[model samples]
Target: MNDLTINTAIQTALPATFLGRHLIDGNWVEGAETFQRVSPSHDTVVSVSAKGDAAVTADAIAAARKAFDAGVWSRISAKERSAVLLKVADLIEANVERIAVQETLESGKPISQALGEVAGAADLWRYAASLARTSHGDSHNSLGADMLGVVVKDPIGVVSIITPWNFPFWILSQKLPFALAAGCTVVVKPSEMTPSSTVMMGELLIEAGLPAGVCNIVLGHGEPVGSVMSTHADVDMVTFTGSTAVGKMITEASAGTLKKVALELGGKNPQVIMPDADLENAADAATFGIYFNVGQCCNSSSRIIVHESIAEGFVARVVALSRKVKFGDPMDPDTQVGAIVTAEHQTKIDGYVKEAVAAGAKLELGGGALSVEGLGPQFYQPTVISNVTPDMPIAREEVFGPVLTVLTFKTLEEAIALTNDSEYGLSAGIWSNDIHTCLEYARHAKAGTVWTNTWMDGYPELAFGGVKQSGQGREIGRYGYDEFLEVKSLVMRVGRDSRKPWVKASA
Candidate 1:
């Protein structure tokens, strides 16, 4: 086996002069001002780029609007559109390794995890291509014999796509390709923290034959650029994936123009483990649930609700498994996990741990940042807390860290009630051998997705979104395509040869 140091691999694998510019209208340019792209693990200057502003954002949106209105790309048939998307997918697959390395370097996720995300991104683009052919219209029966009606799905025009930092490429792929496949032009605003891969995607799309102004990227913070995109009059829809607070702001801003807003926001998802589940497997799954990507995932199983009968065993197993997780340089193949995104985020997560500890919850395994033997800045230990109650702030809030909280429930009803208590319901899981119990929980859990025997498993073929505060609209599957399109009802008079209705009424 190749035993390569993460830092060494990173230094050798990635060139220092990698591109760090915004992609707008199938071309790259420096913004008005500049911002540094710092390495999350070592706190070093990875690169710097011109800071994009509202003007750049507005320019990108205008370009997208022109593309949609001018029918430069939107007027293509579904088959032709699918071919373009398929070509993009092929390009992504061919460059998965480079993209994966970029993702790991910027986002501080394990290299293996980044690779998975890259492959998943390819799958997502391919899935969207498949869906292009399936965007169908429905025929409806009318009241009169001569009257016929149909509902055709049409593109929702220019889309303002603002994606989060954690899974930059993967998340943007989830939103953008489907929008394009639905015949919409897009203006993308990837998070400044991890904008490299997203900008790379723009170049790849251009290489894959995407026309100018069809897909544009403006990299910057959310305050001005994102705000302008959300509030832009020409933008027909806004799709944002980020904090719940910001999502609310986007919704409010979009409301000013009555633009359709699709949000994929925060989650405090619960994982209920019944007495009959395999404790070892469930514990391992739960460990990966929160520890993956250092728990930056919106759907990470943060809440663990175990049956009273096996809570003790599950907690012990989870603690042992958490200890076994090898936290080292992300580039090392042996490293199961890597650093958190930034020092500020590490401090924020540590604060959450401290609060949970102060609130009388037992910090079973880890509860603090780790200055690991060879790592720097953005590293933290995997955390596990037990004996947590529903009322604690840590239990209810979205921590967005590698932290897991465990609680016990005596009955199935209690488990269901506790799981449904959160305002966020992005996704949840139920682990049980009893089919009836699993089925019941799946039916009652107030999340967008419910897992019966597994946790944190997802596919490009399935639709994913949340209800309530977790955000609106779906991504990934056929339902994801529907989010970017609006249904237009068409009516025709097929058999109205005589005007008998008025005559009969007069008689």
Candidate 2:
């Protein structure tokens, strides 16, 4: 179907009844309390979602634990698990339009972007399903004729998955599918700001024939639910994607039980453009990297460190492109830049811009909140601040909005230095024609993933994660499956006589 038809169908068939409940133990359970979900695109109530507290969180954890220990899912063969995951991927693709609509309404991302996210999520699930069958361990052939050593990867057990509001379904797909592929039962806590899509996925899991308690969805604030998920002894692992501050808190909570923790945290990613770079392509990529998803992505290239020779021209091109971005209703397929996820986030974005301008950074483009006649007040204009230094808070901190800061460097060494100076090492990009320069930066950049002449490129086959304070552990590809698995070595002796005489020699 065409885009317009799909959008119209979604609006007409809004699934409001799907809200206000938690999926636990293969049942839709009501929460003790409910919270109204306000759409940032229109400032209207989209739906009411269950606000899971400690009791509800505990129930979900118990369910996951039971599922895992009972071997209802954990004992399934790799082929069986792969089939289920493939079915889930198919279900996601079938409901792409509806998923995209719900995601856009909840997260205030443009409908087009939401569609792309849904597609990416489906791809991730399929990739994970393939990995489920191919994930294999090693055999030690050099153990000699009398001994055999075999290493096998087994499911870690119940996993607690915490996802962020921005790219909600996409991030959940990244973690949940891989964990399930590895035979791990999961208790998912989607960001309360955007929980409807995940709750709907609970239904999809049921339809996909996932066993009871194999996956549970709990929606609520971070305090009680998240605390329980991270600290609960039944949870074998916690996979989180959000702010670094919250990631640290989860890490501390998980320390009590010593549960495995996989975090994909925040980033103030840098995009370096050398003198020989294609100015137009670099500007385009930089603009998309920062403004896409309203710059809420952890790997958003917010920092553009250009060589002095081409700094002014590149900044001018980016500013011109930024001004052209359409800021309007997220539901509109044509919208390029949508609303911030919340009013508070809009304020935060504006505050960062104001602080930067006050601190002497020149505002070359938008620097304030945008108010469309029919849309809500959550929209923030695509902003560009020039002449920023590395020491400035705007340059160092993650704004999590459609805000870009421009800085200049004289040498390649200085560019690498500026990129690695931040505590975060999530992702970065380099725009240069010279292969040597690209290779040098790719090797030295502290970020987990670096793109040459491109920005924000990702694939399911690639391993994505951060380094340093950006967080630990990897997600996607075989490594993502490894996160949910525990390796055990089995050693056996065949055709050997047992003898123990070391202690008897003295006697």
Which candidate number would show the highest lDDT if scored against the true structure?
Answer: 2
> What lDDT does model 1 reach?
0.86
Candidate 2, residue 302: how far the Cα is off, in Å: 0.2
RMSD of each: 3.2, 3.7
CA lDDT of 117 in candidate 2?
92
Q: Model 1, range 206-288, lDDT digits (tens) per residue?
A: 98898899998888888898999999999999999999999999999889899999999999999999988987788888988
TM-score of every candidate: 0.95, 0.96
RMSD (CA, Å), candidate 2 to true, equals: 3.7
lDDT of each: 0.86, 0.88
lDDT of 2 by residue, 1-507 (tens): 011111111133344633658999999998768998888876778878888899999999999989999999899898999998899999999999988888888888988999999977989999999998998999887878777799999999999999999989999999999999999999999998999889878889999999999999898999899999999999999999999999999999899999999999999999999999999999999999998998999989999999998888888899877766666777777787787888888888889899988989999887877767666778777788998988999999989998999999999999999999999999999998999999999999998899999888899999999998899999998887799999999998878756455677654
The 10 consecutive residues of candidate 2 with the worst lDDT sum are 1-10
How many clashes in each candidate?
Answer: 2, 0
Regions of model 2 farther than 4 Å from truth: 1-18, 498-500, 503-507
